[model samples]
Target: MGKATGFLEFDRLSEQNIPPHERVKNYKEFVLHLTDEEAKVQGARCMDCGIPFCNNGCPVNNIIPDWNDLVYRQNWEEAIKVLHSTNNFPEFTGRICPAPCEAACTLNINSDAVGIKSIEHAIIDKAWELGLVKPQVADKKTGKKIAIVGSGPAGLAAAQQLARAGHDVDLMEKNDRIGGLLRYGIPDFKMEKSHIDRRMEQMAAEGVNFLTNHNVGENIHPDDLIKDYDAVILSGGAEWPRDLPVPGRELDGVHFAMDFLPSQNKVVAGDKLSEQILATDKHVVVIGGGDTGSDCVGTSNRHGAKSVTQFELMPQPPEKENKSMVWPYWPLKLRTSSSHEEGCDRDWSVATKELIGDNGVVKELVASRVEWKDGKMAEIPNSEFRIKADLVLLAMGFVSPQQSILEKFGVDKDARGNVKADTEGKKAYFTSRDKVFAAGDMRRGQSLVVWAIREGRQCAHAVDEYLMGSTSLPR
Candidate 1:
């Protein structure tokens, strides 16, 4: 450790965010990254806690204490080296990851965590500014051709790793653009597309081929990739949004979060859609209280919705967690997102009963408060309510990967519909079909971006080992 007493001397500090009112006016990143000195002080707060549970908390197992020490010493160069040793994309995780690592922080047991994510944001941003992030051209070619379907974090990570290992990597994307959810599903205000763009450039320089508008099982055939490529890796994320099966689900003006989110992202990227869904002056009701629902709230506010309200079926969690009961693990607690702060009426323990429409367009919705007992839910009698809603957005989260591609590939699927594949032992990541593998949301169901990167890197190593009988790629 750089300073044994540093943790005692310094307090935890995090990145500052712009006021919600001002930030919601436009779809742009509002988080102010930590300055160099602020980051150093935050880094100094990492205790000499020998275990570093933050590593286990992080999906990629980042070397936290070492980098914290390096950053506290102002050794920026080596800090990034330690960072890149485990996680391939720090900037993405730094910005959007929920930072489970912080919850597992030793300091968090008593006080605030060390602001590790902000330090990572600083390190990666500084590395790029100093031109420390450069392409690693392979010194030798293994003559193996690999096709990675879906250009999300998982696919991108695997492609970069395999290409750097001297293999020919072809990244296939169904959309016109490269990034999957990063390019479409996520709102621009949360994270700009330029981050994904820069990483794509780095991967391309390392000999990975980017093939956009290539929808396997549709415009492109899964058999084609299987026949031409030496190995096939599936990273296509879960795209199946869980639907509300209540009455009037087919009414007009009701849509899925994926449909609503991607349209705005396309508009931001200069695409013109004649039939774009808009919340302008509409009474918007977002269903489900997850990140997607919050995103709907933010976007609706940006579009000048007359009113915004969000509903959650589950009971509201406590604002604070009992650390003693759930230390070093992700605890269940109430989380208020920036969008909620922007302006939203939030109701918990409520579930939608039905959507009502006039002239075939949804005009209102009925809901009822629920009570849970013995692991089962029962509606509270006479607790029914109604809310005006000119537009309804379903953000109840994804159920599984879209079955089309998986069906076309004849890949075995788990009970939840994700492509079935194991993560341990030799031939790990191998799908039921020979010469095929699966990872990320496609295999594990919907998850965070950090976990996707970890799965991608590990899957890449598995593929490399299967092909060349050895692998140097990190797990």
Candidate 2:
């Protein structure tokens, strides 16, 4: 610990944000990172707790206390070194990850947890400004070729690690751009696409080939990759969105959150789409109470929607958790995102009964209050209600990856339809098919970006070992 009594002397300092009224007018990041001194104070709050559960709490197992001590000592270069040693994309995690590490912090048992995410953001931004982030080009080539499908966090991490291990890596994306989900699934208002572009540039300098518009199952056959490359890794996301199967779901104005979100991201990137699903001057209803739903709220507000309302099928969680019972683990609690803070009418324990439409466009939503007992749901008697809705966005999360891709590769699938692959033991990340591997959402179903990165790094380590009969890459 940098300062033994620093936790007692300092109070938590939160990052600032642009006022909702002002930020809603445009699609750009509004949350401001902490200043150097503010970050220093926040970092100093890390206690001498003997054990750092935050490391285990993070999906990528970030060395939180070490970086906190470095930041407190103003060792900016070393802070990023420690950060990058574990996380390949701190900028992404620092901006959008839910920060489970904070929930597991020892200080969180009674006091506020240290702002580890904010410190990470500061360190990465400082590292970039100081030209400390650069390509780690390999000195010798391994004379092996590998193909990684999907350019999401997992694929990106795997490609970079394999490239650095002296292998020829081709990172492929089905879309016209890289960053499978990060390119479109996320809103630019939360994180600009420039961060992804910058990392791609660094990766290109490291000798990882970028192949866009390369749909494996559609245009590029699995046989070609199996024949041309020494090994193939599937890292695509869980793209099969869960649908609301009620009547009138065929209405024109109703769409999946993914279909609506990507259009805006493409427009922001200067791509001209002939038609966009806009929320302007319309009564918008977003179904589901997750990050995707919150993103819809934010984008609707930016589109100048007449009114925005969100619905959740589950009951609302408590505003605070009983830390004694849930210490060192993630707890279920009420979470209000920045988008919710901007402007949104949120309701829980409500289920949609049907969608009322006119002229093939959605016009109203019929829903009812429900109660849960013994993990079963029952609608309340005579609690049906109707709400005006011109546009309905379903953000209820994804169910699994596209089965077509897995079928084309002839790889075994789990019961949940994700590519069947283990994370430990001798056959780690290896699919039933010869020389084929899977990681991230493609193997583990839908999950956080940090977890995806962790799987990618571990999968790369496994692949390198399989190819060379041994590996020096970190797991």
Candidate 3:
């Protein structure tokens, strides 16, 4: 609601990316954020929708209109306040989230949607530049202790909220670093690790205790945490990657996406590995067409792979979605990542048949074109083919949280092997065990970072109310 006629006055403007040729040379952020004027113009494009379906579309329920108005008025300070009121880490989402908010915008019915994500990115970048982001230490210490296992987005968000609520919170992680998959699975080009480091600094100032390399049920006993803390929240993300179990699956060149991704991250952090699974001068075939698959393609290209190809089992979706049919909801459509721009041959309706190799080393992959009718998939007759693939990365998404952690806690799991917990009612976020709760990908299975942040914030409120019978933390 910037100008009432602002939508007509200004057109949607998106953030620009560095050229693919130049960006592929380095593992750094290539997307250039909008200037203050560009961001203000973009923010002004938001129409004063009576319902504001953008809010409904956002998983964290961000106040889009309020912030858009604020940004248009040049209230950078107030814009960050509103943005952070709901999102604990706007910087994370601003960089990587697929903005569903824009899709639900009223202007999207015909014209381009407001650049909400770009404005968000601008607001946060300015906030950091002006040093507006600071730790909010609790005025009083409640003395009650809480243990949160995992260091992913959900765990980090919950720990921050609980710490600010006058509670002593212990954030534990098995990895040597804080961000679970964010630190490893994601490429540095999407978001620099410094963002996580800054949050860690602020959280430390807020009295959140972090324990790294504390793998529960192994080095650390789960019973100790349950016994010592007044409450426990599990936010360990889904880590068990969905793997292809076919002939020659045990080949040396066939590796999970997690294995390939984490190694690259470690190298970027200056960890010299004697042996690393490299894609240099080798043809690669990634099995999956999701974000993770795109990441594999990008990483392989940076490594100077001879060729890159990606396969999706389902048929290709349309480049544009029917807004009339899927308005205010996530729609199926073709998505090409920045990595795809670097260079990748993508195919749909193709399924990997088998890994062909010699001496237990993957050299090629056999596949078949598939056709889907109703809900069934069938291989097309006489459509078998083969492609050279020295490296194979299975990026078919995760199936469940690592069973070892969930099993050790003895928490009940839903049919999908996720931690059994309701999102509503009096028992919200409460697990089968007393004083035990779960959130994030561990509870909801694999999902977007924005969704994980929402679950974390809500779960924190639920925990706070359960302990104190009242809470001020926003859900």
Candidate 4:
């Protein structure tokens, strides 16, 4: 341990964020990272417990304590090595991930947890500045070709691993550009696209081919991939968004969050729109309270929305978790994101009855207060109200993987409509179709970027085993 009593002597410190007013003026990263000495102190807060639950809490199973000590001792080069061992992109996770590892920290029992995420952020940013990260090209050629369907974190992870293992890897994306959600779904303000671009450059150097504007099931045939590649990995994400079937759902301004988010991202990337879907000078109501909803709020603010409000069907969680009961596990608590602080009216236990509009353009939302009785929600009879809303975004989350592509492969799906694949036991990650494997959101449904990376890494190992009989890649 860096210091035996570091945990007792030090308190936790989080990274600062740019003022909401200043940040909303443009699309750029707002979080100000910790200075080197501050980061060291935060790293010192890690107890380096004998059994680090933080490791277990991390979906990528990052060696948390080891890296914490490395950073605390200012062994930055080694810290980056340890961070990269499990996670392919710490910069992505550092900004977007909720940091379940901090919640699961041994020190969080009665005090603030170690600032693991910030430490990771500092290490990676420093590594890049020092030109420490580079492509690791394969020394020998396996001559076997592999096709990865999707260019998100999962597909990128699998493609990089397989390519380094001497397989010719092709990462395919249906979109006009690569990075899938990373390139489009996420706003540049949260994490700039340059991070993805730099990694893509490195992957290219490692001999991974990226084919954008290539829709596998539509443009390219499934049979063609089967005939050409030795094996195929389906990392296409769960994209079928959940919808509200309320009255007036067909209104012009009522749209899914995905429908709205991507356009703004494109605009930020310098794409001029003929008819932009904007929330500017309008009352915006974002349904569902989660990361996607928060993102909508932030984007709407950037668009100079007249007003923004978010709705959550469930009641607000406790401000502080009962640590004795929830320690070492992610707790249910109120999470006020940076977007929320940027000026948003948040309402809980609310349900939208319908979109009230005139001439097919949304004017307001008819909503009602709701109460859960016996685990089922019911609208209160006298609590109905109308709220002005020119733009209504349904950020209620995704339902399943798009059926068209999954149907094209004829892969079996579970009751939840996710690809049927065991994450454990002998046939892990293998789909019902031979030589076809699935991972990430396609298999596990909508999830965090960290979980996607983990599944991608593990699925790569499974695919490697199927190809070589025995594999050296870590699961």
- On the 0 to 100 scale, the lDDT of residue 306 in model 1 is 97
Q: Tell me the alpha-carbon RMSD of every candidate.
A: 0.9, 0.6, 0.8, 0.9
Candidate scoring better on lDDT of 2 and 4: 2
Q: In candidate 3, residue 380 scores what lDDT?
A: 95
Q: Please identify which of the two predictions, 1 or 2, would achieve the higher lDDT against the true structure.
A: 2
Q: List TM-score per model, in order.
A: 0.99, 0.99, 0.99, 0.99
**Measured by TM-score, how close is model 2 to the native structure?**
0.99
lDDT of 2 by residue, 292-338 (tens): 99999999999999999999999999999899999889999999999
Cα deviation of 402, candidate 2, in Å: 0.4
lDDT of 3 by residue, 1-475 (tens): 7688999988778789999999988899998999998888888888887999999889999999999999889899999999999999999999999999988888898888889999999999999999999999999999899999998999999999999999999999999999988898889989889999999999999999999999987999888999999999999989898989888898989998889988988899889999888899999999999999999999999999999999999899999999899987888999989999999999999989899899889999999999999989999999999999899999999999988888899999999899999999999999999999999999999999999999999999999999999999999
Tens-digit lDDT track of model 4 for 106-144: 888888888999999999998998899999999997888
Name the lDDT of candidate 2: 0.96
